[model samples]
Target chain A: MKTKKLINDPKVIIEEMLEGIVAAHPKHVRQVEGAPRAVVALNGPRKGKVGLVIGGGSGHEPTFVGFVGKGLADACPIGNVFASPPPDPIYECAKAASGGAGVLFMYGNYAGDVMNFDMAAEMAGMDEIEVRTVLTTDDIASAPLDQKEKRRGVAGNFFIFKIAGAACDTMKPLDECERLARKANAHTYTMGVCLSPCSLPQTQKYSFELGPDEMEIGMGIHGEPGVAKGPIQTADAVTDAIMDKILGEMKPNKGDKVAVLVNSLGATPLMELYLLNRRVKQRLDQVGVSIHQTWVGNYCTSLEMAGASITLLHLDDELTGLLDHPCDCAMFRAG
Target chain B: MKTKKLINDPKVIIEEMLEGIVAAHPKHVRQVEGAPRAVVALNGPRKGKVGLVIGGGSGHEPTFVGFVGKGLADACPIGNVFASPPPDPIYECAKAASGGAGVLFMYGNYAGDVMNFDMAAEMAGMDEIEVRTVLTTDDIASAPLDQKEKRRGVAGNFFIFKIAGAACDTMKPLDECERLARKANAHTYTMGVCLSPCSLPQTQKYSFELGPDEMEIGMGIHGEPGVAKGPIQTADAVTDAIMDKILGEMKPNKGDKVAVLVNSLGATPLMELYLLNRRVKQRLDQVGVSIHQTWVGNYCTSLEMAGASITLLHLDDELTGLLDHPCDCAMFRAG
Candidate 1:
């Protein structure tokens, strides 16, 4: 089967894409002093503020790099498509984002990211900069309640990063920022449905397979196996099936307030995503769940896969304040 | 051929999508009093500014609708999937955006849009409200230089609308706003390539067809035919092929400053768009063309088509200020 892609060498796409990103927003971001894959904020970084750092694979853009700006991640070490960034760049990001208050490393939890970011933290420690890690485990379908630690992070990373970044903007200590990020991750629940598989540039092969008339729910961002595979269903039915799982795990009360996100997974059109959002709001309204804030569109993606994910971040008073804190980044902004 | 989509009923998708957009952004936009398809900014319209109204087919998501907000378009009348909005919504949009000052009507130059918008303008005139129109013909590949007026608009609509909106924000009169929009359109050039066709929900069939191993350069956003078709090429080569025609039409000289946009037509990933941008800047660098600002993303999309478009807008001092004006909307915002 032939795959559609535009690249000179799939092998060097990371380097090329990073160069383009920095060139596009030189005033907002730049390459970390010496690291090619590590990017840092250019205009504003206050001294003695807890520096926020994020890292992950490159495919889910706007995630790691787009979030690197004022009131968001101070620096981001980018990796190849669907693969964790190298420790060298991660260490460099920590170094560049360092303030007297120290740095916090946050990212979706995967074996590769966990290992590499942990190693990078250790390397940064040798340089006398304190670094903390907050791994997002928000995909409810990835693990049972008793084993939440094993769940993979998905689109829920948006809320976690946003809250953490906003907290950091207040000049809070690194520990407080890390705590808020962990709280955001804990309150967030997400489930994704993949209608089709996405291919990598080098392989020309899909990361996973489904029939022309099938969907897989709870699929990981890297196309890892999901909880279920079923025949194609209507938008309403699909939302019901995925929401049933998310809400069941969340167990929200009638008066609970939640931030809702209906995110597109790569190739899904905005028209379809908007349609799905209508269904999501209808379901939430039926359940008496008050939507505090709603975001819909391509926040997180998996290259060209056709699918979407719904995330609900149950908010308490403190969580609400943290989320409502204003922050402006390349891909996201809130007040 | 069957198409995979996440939608309820094709007939009601337009209504559903509009509802979803407003529900998620009640603070930013709303449905016009009597017109469901005509959306207006929730913020009050000023008394003396030339109200900006834009509209076109619906499938172009943010292009025609998401741009409605402060410092951007005041209203957008939406049509069905890739079809021209009727005179009803267009007229209603003008009426809703009217603030005693005349309204400025601008949109892509499609036969349907032209005819319908003209009808709407005539209806508004009957009510004693002044309206002027500017049709964007930025797609350099759609027609030869001799037939420039026949060219279709693509991603260049972003620049045209941004500048026009900034002009309207500054309380420019209708004639001045119209002139600025026309100038922006004239200074903009765009070229697109299509690797696959997107389907309309009503018809679960691909809008057009191409070989699995081929792509069409200069294809219209609505799957209209282009100037050439060929096998898939490297990102550099594809960028070169498209830029050659654009630069030839633009004839940009050394030291000329411009805004560059590498837009995903639909399914192309950020990774690919960035790679393409790298090539675009390289080519421009070779010719001493300086990029004033750059954007890379899915600015204007065609459902889920698998390709991208590149737009270059030559900028003078005035145009640069207009582009730099801050505007916050559902899908776009800049400073």
Candidate 2:
């Protein structure tokens, strides 16, 4: 199949996208001096505040870059599509985002991201800046409960980031912000299903192959192998399958309240997400769990990959208060 | 092509979707009593305020329904797929939204919508509830400059509804709100390109057809024929073509400021939209028209159609202030 993308050249796609982002959101973000890959929020970093820096692969837009602004991420170091950023840009982002209260690095728990961000933290330490790291592992299907640390982060990262961003915005110390980030990640869970493969911009080639009538549950955002592959099923059946896995592990008691996000991976439309949400609500209702807040849209995506993910952030009083705090980002706003 | 969708019983897609929306956004919106098709905002309508009621076909996910919340539309009566709602539900929407100041009806300039909304206005009139209407005609390619009123509305409807919503929310009288709505519609210009067709829920068939290597410029949201059709071009070429028509119609002087919306119709990802925005910025920079604010996303979508639209709202102090006013909606929140 033809790529059918609206791009000038794939090699310069990231640069063009970054330029486009800064142009479109000049008031919210700006590229760091001498480091084009590092985008820092214009109004987020302040003295006496713990700076928040997030970064990852580029395809999942509105994730790292779009989250940079007041009351959210202080800076975002961008990478090429489906690839992690190098330590230089990450270090630059840390340097640019650092307030007197220190800085925290947060991103999805991937091998490349972990390695690169650790090296950047080392660099920041050598520069006499305190930097902490929190890796988000929220995808329940990637690992068993006994091995939760191995789980990959997906759309649940949105909630984790939001809670941490709120903490940082409220002048929380580095220890408190790091604790809240870990707490948010521990409470968040997500699972995804892929209907079709997305092609890479550079190669214009499919990342993975599936039969035309087949779908895959528990697929990774970067087209990693999924837990199950079978013929496409109805929306309710699919939702039930994913919810079974989540509910089996979560085991929330009655009266528990959680925030929900039915997110489109990219090509999935809002109509389908809402359909999935209907079943999710029904399943939660059957279990006597109540939804506190719900967000349905393309929050974290894998380029034009056709899929959707459901994320639940089990909220406590503190988490709920933080989740409801005002945030003004380039792509996300809430109170 | 085989229809691969995450839905059950396409016959009840709308009802299920409405149920899903209410379940997810209970704090922001609710279904009107005895009027299943009518959704009213939970916090927007106030006594003595000029109520804003916006509606249209249902396929545009966030257009009519997602926009109903505080500081936006007071209510939205949904239609079926690409069809318009009948007079009964629209009348109910007016009656439920009225706050004694009056009610204003706003939507795209479509034949079915105009007819139904007019009949609903007549019904509201019989009940002694003053009613006004403002039709958005912003698709520059749909009609000649001399025949502007014949043009169809598209994604530009976001700005029109936003400005009018702000006007009504601030307690502007019905006449002033109507004037502002008309002003906003006159200043907005939009053009779209279609890369592929979207399948209807009921039929599970493509709404329109295009060759593998072809695209149509200025296609309507519901797959209406466009002004130009030919082989696919580069992103810059496509953006240039669309901007040419919009700029020609707008003809803003140098140093003038405007707001920009690089909107995805549905399946076109943010990666492509930013690429288009890059070109759009370049084109505007060459002409010296500065962008005051930019929104890039799927604001008004046509199910899973693969395409995008560019909307420019020429802004003065009033329009700029109104655009920046805070709005808390289920799908769109902006300030």
Candidate 3:
């Protein structure tokens, strides 16, 4: 395989990306000095609003950082591509986004992020800035359904963040915000597949290998191997496979209202995502599940992997209203 | 080269992509029916505001479509892959964005886009909706300064869009908006290097080819051959080469206020863009052009090419103010 020189050094790449992100959305987000890698909401400390902070890696453009604004994550502690931010940066971000009301550390269920955010939450607690953690364990394929707590987080995170952030945006108490976030997590399920592997910029080699016609199903976003491998199939076939697994695990009842998210895993085109969404919608309709809203695009990506994921979120009146809430961020808007 | 099967047939790709774009930023942007390929501002009829519309190809995600909102292009017409949109889409977009006020079509100076946009302008005139066209011809290498009108546009287009969009947002006259956009095009210059080729989904083959260690300098966003190709070098050297050419042609004076944009040609990493930005800032500073603002990211792209471009826009008071103007778009915001 051929390799191209990377555009920047790894150390300061996320910081510079943050600079561009802040400049692009100055009114919505701001960068913290001591925590240059962290981006916080410009109108944060909404004076009694529960602040929600989320972050993981940087290369996932628009993930933790781009979503930092009203109706979303309050601040993001960006690390290197697919790497967790150090504990110090995470702590500072928690402090910065925290109002007198307290802060929620909502991060993907990755070991690195979990450990660092836990450390940061502990540190924030010492500073009298109340802190809590709500890990998104929505990737059902990542673990057994009986042990959902061990599932990895995936694009379904956007759903959790949206509902949780909306509650906070409306000045929900810290406990209420955390409760809503957990509830959202419980109802959400995501499963991903990958056709290509990501190359670490410094290494310039695939982190994992895949046969040309082979794809990994139930894969994590970071190019990690999945629970199963299968021959590449049609968009509908792939969508059916993912939907069957997710719905079977989620076990949505007939007539249940849910939101569907067909997330492009990095390099999948919109045409493919929509095709997959169509299949997913059709399958759900046949099963008597009503999709209240649907999002088809690249939300959670894994570098340049040409694949997609399906995330289903069961919704109630409050959750549905929160999901429909308006947002203004550089990369996404829920309304 | 090997080919992989994507999820969908080519027939309905653009339609689905547009739908996803609208769903992604529903409040800020939506699709116009007759203009099936156009994404227009959701906030219609801004009373006295001048409307700005810009577009060309489809694969340059976030460039034409992502820029449609307040303080930016009011609408965008998307073509397939690197192709230019037909006149009908552009005309429908211009009509939708126009609110009795005149409209400015600020598109990159590519033959297809220019021809179609001109046709759209003529159609708009027939409808009595005043319209003007401002072509961005910032690729100095594409044409000699004496023949600037023939130059092709590249990454410097962001400058024209920002400045002209801000003026329009302020309800500036159509003539004023066009003049500012033209001025921005004159002061701006860009040079790009492509480390790899990007493939069209339909073709499933690279638009063009490049060697493992060869980089194309002065490359257009489309797959057109670059001005020159050379042995790949260090990030600093590559950045210096691109910046020297752009700055020398721009002839930025000492202490000249300027804005710098380091654009990724798609697959380039954030780290690489920052490294290139570092070298570009140092080179420009050595030449006495102080960077008043710096933007580094994937703004205008060429599919998934692994490369980056450097853009320098000489900023006067008006240009700087425009650069500083407030914007609220799906992908970019500036204030």
Candidate 4:
């Protein structure tokens, strides 16, 4: 498609967006010059509090950036849309957030993010900063629970963030913080269905394609291919398809408590998410999995695709308390 | 071109979306069940506080609904994408929000919104409920300021919301609140450019079209036909063209304080919005217009259109105080 270039240059889009982020949110986040998406806490770290950090591509709002605030990730390094941020930015974020107690790096299971964050951890160690990495591999379709390294991260990353934020608030050591984040990730699973492909700005075209009336199941946020495609179904059916996989993997038994997130992948209206959420709660209720809380909205979107994703996180006492912690931001806040 | 039938029935899209809004913001907003997009104060209005109600279409997140909080609009009556909510719903919103101090009905200047909100005003009057309408007609291309009725409302509706919200919070009477809102709207002006069209759920297709390398200037939120269409160009050139008309109408004098909003039309990424915002600020700086504050993001979106609109609200002491008032919500809290 022929599209107007709204950016001065394709190269500067990421840097400029980071600058605007600093301008718009002076209290919650600050960006270092020449380091795009390398955001840190404006108020430093609270004494006796562990620090939490997360990072990924730039397109998803309220994710790596929007989720940075009290009772959430203390700092988030952002990459360009559909791209992974580099190691230096990640390293800087860790250093800035580390409160003397230590810092935990919680990120999605994407290969690029994993590799870059690992390198940054090594760098942080050289600077006498204790850092640990917690990878979230919650897409059940990507791998079995025993082989979580192969799974792709999805909306369940929110669970990891919530746990890490809460653990850090209690001043857990780096080891404990990483352990809790991993535990949260292991207990969470997510699956998504897309009605349309998300478009890239510079490319000015969709990242992928599917037939009309077709939906892709178990898709990743970066427009990665899905596990299956089939004729469109009712919202209830789609919710069942996603929740079944997530629930099966989590294996919640009777009386088990969980938090559910019904996320819109950009273009889906709020109406469909609610309808799908209602069906999800109904199905879960029948299965005896008690939904302690629910988050339904565009917390994680894939550009403008008409799609939705479902994520379920089995919760424990610590996780539940963390999830209940208050958050404050323009995109999301939970108390 | 063909499109997918994502929902069971196209007609149910709006109803479903509103249900999702209620689910997502249960603590902050509640859907007037069976009433299309009419949401009232979750915690009933504070006694003796004036009420501010505003709304229009569904796709503009936090615009009408997201802005509802302590220092902004109290309720919103939503319509389908780019459509106005009915008079009944708007009236319900007014009735629910109004305290003994009366109500201020702020809205965009679209024909449907204007007509429906006006009707609601008359209905509220019949019930002996004092109500006033502050119509926002900021799109410069739609009409000249001298011909107020000809101007179309756009993103500048936010300025009215801010002013009205503050006025009402201070217990201003119905007429004073309306006067302040209208004054803010009158001092503001806006213009937009569309690189892509927003897809309405029911239509399952884009509302308008642009060739692969083309853009429409002076476009409306509803995909109302623009004043011009031409091949896409550099960000600087596009900014120059759009700001010329908006600034010409509002005519921000040198040394005058003003607030700028560079808004994304749903699908545009934050990276691009910031780039556009940078150019916008640079242009305004060159023109010697002092920017009191600026915000750039998807404040008012049109489905998933990959375009943007700019709004300039001339700031005086009253408007500044209103803009500084604190707000708390999931989307925007510009108090």
Candidate 5:
């Protein structure tokens, strides 16, 4: 079947989307000079404040770009579709977002991103601008417990970024912000199940395929092979399966508090997410772990893939305060 | 093909979804006493303040229920999928939401909704609680200009509700709040295109059907017939067709400002919406009209249908101020 998408030429798709975002949120972000792939916040970067720079592949709208604004991300270097951006835009983003205090780079743990962002860090270092890196590895299903560092990040990036943004916006030192970001990542866990595949704009081709009645659990956002593939199950069953792995690793005690995010992969409707939330809350309540706050929506997505993921951020006093901090972004806001 | 949903039982889908929403946002809303179908904001209603109650069918998430919170809707009466609520729940919502100043009911213009809400208003009258209502008729494609009252409400309900919420939260009387809501509805226009059909939960059958390469423009949210159907066209072409109708209706002078909403009906992604936004901005620029603000997301949806809609709200000072007012809701927020 022909790919049914509302787009013009795919080559200009990323550019058009960037232009659209800028046009819609002129007060929040602007394209960086000489860096068409980088956008900097209009009100975020200030002297003596730590700067936060976030980036990832395209197609995940509102992930890397929509979060660029005051009290969120100072800048975001965008990639092409599911590919990492080249070093040039990353360098430009670092320069544009850097306040006198320094710049910090944060993104999902992917090889291409690591290589490109590292090269950008080297370039920034040569300019006497201090730089730091914090990688997100929150997908609990991507690796064994002992190999957690090898795991891929997914929707859990939302909470990690929120905490880092709060730290930077509060003028936390570079070391402190990096420490908090790492801490946030360590406390986060996520797992997802995919019911269908998403197509690429350029090729108009499906990234992967599944039977109409099938589902793949622990699938990577880029259609990477998942841990299990089987017949689709009820919402409660799926929630239990994913939460089993998360709870096994988290092992929260009674009276513990955690923030929850039931995120759509892409095409899944809010109705399904709410159904999942119902089961998630039931499981958490059984364990005596109170939910500090909950967010349910399409925070992270894989084009139009049909699925959902649940993210838990085990919270403490500091983390809860950070999560509740005021923030204003083009696509997300909290107070 | 089998319907791939994460639901346990379609019979209890609405109840489960409502339970999930309350569980995730206990601080924002709660079920009204003895009224299982009604939810009242925990922080919205106040003595001597006009109370705002918004409701409709269940499939459109974040429309009526998600907008219940401080400075937004005081209560929401939910219905079955794509159907209107019964009069008992509507009356219960009015009672629970009413402050001493009175209550204002707002919802999309539909036969069942009109009839039921009218009955609820009558019930409220016997209780000595004054009530007023303003029905939204913003879908310009649903009727001719000479018979505009016959038009249906669509995604434009977002802006209309936002304005009415601000009006009531600011302590406006029922008459004034109702007037402002009527004014907001008059200034809004919307049009939508459907690419695929959504299935009802109970039957798990498609609500409507179209060929693989076909798209229907001006389709209603509930799969009502549209004005035209043809092979899917390029994004730009489709955008032009929709914008042409909108511009013909809204003949603004140079420098006119308006708020724009590029809404996903369900399965459409942000990538497509941004593409639509790009063309939308191009079209507005050509006409010398400026966008005061733009929102692109799934504000109102038709289950898991694949489609998009564009809504424009012609803004004057009062409407602009209300749109910019602070709001804290479960699924939407602004400041």
Candidate 6:
């Protein structure tokens, strides 16, 4: 069967979606003037406060845009499915989020996002709006333990965005907010597994093929290769496998507190996520890692891809307080 | 490929999921002692307030369980996949939620849930605790206008639950809380379309089949047949088709306000939901209905089902205020 989609013209999907978002959430967001792809907070970037701008490809709903709210990202420039926004919108986002205080640009460390955001930062510099970039590298499977800098960011982007956004709400200086964001990134870890592939609207073809009994561990959000592929395993076995890799790297000692996220990668059901969480909590209990909180739902996705990712954010007293901060956006709000 | 799922035993899925939920959200919820499937709010059902218990089948996560928090449903009983909870758990849920005041049992109006909840209510009545039920029959395609009571509930359950829960927060009496619930259900209307079918874990077989180019309009949450089936259509066309049936029966005059929910049935991407919402907002605009707030995500799902549902709650001042009232839940919160 052909992959079915509800779209008019694939090329204009992003613009149409942006229009819908701003219209549906007029009080929360608006399109940046002359930057159709940039979605800016309607009530953010107040005076004497550092501005936080986040962006990345589309498909990961509530990730880059749903997170932009009163105390989260001030602006998010959207891109095509699994692709990065261009420099123009990214620059416009920096300008919009700039509250006289300098701007901080953050996103998952994809090659396209890094290049385009870097370009946008350069453009913001030309306008005398200083900008700093923090590329999130939390996907443990993307790189070896000794080379964590090369890891790709996955669901852990949510934590980095929240910590930095909360810091900005305190009217913190740009340097301090950037430091908090880096610290958040350093303590975050994520790993994912995909059961099926997601097709693109334009192409109408599946991105990858897996056998009936196969599962791929550490699959990237955009169908990038993972560390291993084998027959599908039980929920407990899968948890152990993924956690083995993450805990090996993160190594949160006993008595440490952490926040856990069991996120669906598009098409996975909540029942499955919760079932997986059952084992996740068991393992955390055995390891003596105290769960400060838990978020289980479809937070970041791959546009109908069938999979899930687990994210762990090891929290200190400071990080816990910052994460508990409240903010309201379109799809997510937390305190 | 076979339908992939992350579960240990299909037989114990509900029990295991409930365990995970209480473990992960100890502050928000707990499993009623000796009634493991009956999940009750840890901090709710306080004295003097009207107790609110809402529940239904499993698979539609964040619907019945996620809504159990402060100012929302005080309890929700777990069921097997796509099946309703038995009377025992439902009865226990009511007893746990009861705090001297009466209990209001609200949920989707399906035969199984109705029968089970009715049995539970009868049991509660034996204890001298008044129990009132507000059955949601809001699916526009399920019945004729004059036979609205015969309709089945779909995504509209969210609005009904929220409004009724908010009313209970006012410490209203049983009759008044039931009145508010009935008012909320009367104003709520929903329509859904499916692009693919969901499979059961035990069977690993698709619930239904659509040709590569086919779609089903007004499909029920559990793969029940819809009002119409045809070749797949564009996003705008689909939205217009769904909205036409909704508006024809609703007949909302100009100057009416509404809360819109563009819900994904498990696997539909958020981009498509937004694309559909663009047309929904446009049609509502042309019809002169003012959108008060919009929600676009996986609110009600069918366990990896690929479809979307649209729900509109025509709101008066009271309902609108109640909807905007603050409530903190596991998956949903509003202020």
Best by DockQ: 5
Q: In candidate 3, what are the lDDT values of residues A1-335, reduced to their tens digit? A: 64566445545556655655665456678888877878888765578888889889866665677678877888888888888998998998888888789999998889999889988989998999999899999888888988888888889988998888888898989999999999999989898878777776667677788887888888888876688897777676777788888877778789889998887665555545656766776688798988787776557776666677889999888899989887766566655
Best by lDDT: 5
Docking verdict class for candidate 2:
medium
Q: Between which residue pairs do clashes occur in model 3?
A: A6-B272, A7-B272, A7-B273, A8-B271, A8-B272, A8-B275, A24-B333
lDDT of candidate 5 over B212-288, digit per residue (tens): 89999999999989999999988889899999999899888899999999999988999899899999999999999
List residue ranges in candidate 4 displaced over 4 A.
Answer: A1-5, A33-37, A46-48, A199-205, A251-258, A269-275, A281-296, A304-306, A328-334, B33-37, B253-256, B287-293, B329-331
Instruction: Answer with 3 or 4, whichever has the higher lDDT.
Output: 3
**lDDT by residue (tens digit), candidate 1, A192-277:** 99988889888978877888888888888888888888887888888898888878888888998999898888899888888878
Question: For model 2, what share of native contacts is present?
Answer: 0.69
DockQ of each: 0.75, 0.74, 0.23, 0.37, 0.82, 0.76
Please give the CA lDDT of all the candidate structures: 0.88, 0.92, 0.78, 0.75, 0.92, 0.90
The TM-score that candidate 2 achieves is: 0.98
* Chain B TM, every candidate: 0.98, 0.99, 0.96, 0.93, 0.99, 0.98
Query: A-chain TM-score per prediction?
Result: 0.97, 0.98, 0.96, 0.94, 0.99, 0.98
Q: What is the docking quality class of candidate 3?
A: incorrect
Model 4 pairs whose backbones collide: A2-B212, A2-B213, A62-A66, A271-B16, A271-B17, B62-B66, B324-B335, B325-B335, B326-B335
Ranking by DockQ: 5, 6, 1, 2, 4, 3
Clashes by residue pair, model 6: none
Per-residue accuracy of model 6 over B1-335 as CA lDDT, tens digit each: 56788888888888888888877788888888998888888777888888999998988987889899998889998888877899999999988889888999988879999999999899999988889888989898888888988989888898999999999887888888899999999999999999999998888789889888999999999988899999999999999999998898789999999999999999998899999999999999999999999988888899888889999999899899889878877778888
Q: After superposition, how far is residue A127 of candidate 2 from its true place, in Å?
A: 0.6
Q: lDDT score, residue A323, model 5?
A: 90
Q: Give residue A284's error in model 3 in angstroms.
A: 7.1
Question: By TM-score, how accurate is candidate 3?
Answer: 0.83
Order the candidate numbers by lDDT, best to worst: 5, 2, 6, 1, 3, 4
Q: Per-prediction RMSD in angstroms?
A: 1.4, 1.3, 4.2, 3.1, 1.1, 1.2
- Number of the candidate with higher DockQ, 3 or 5: 5
Q: Which 10-residue window of candidate 2 chain B scores lowest in summed lDDT?
A: B1-10
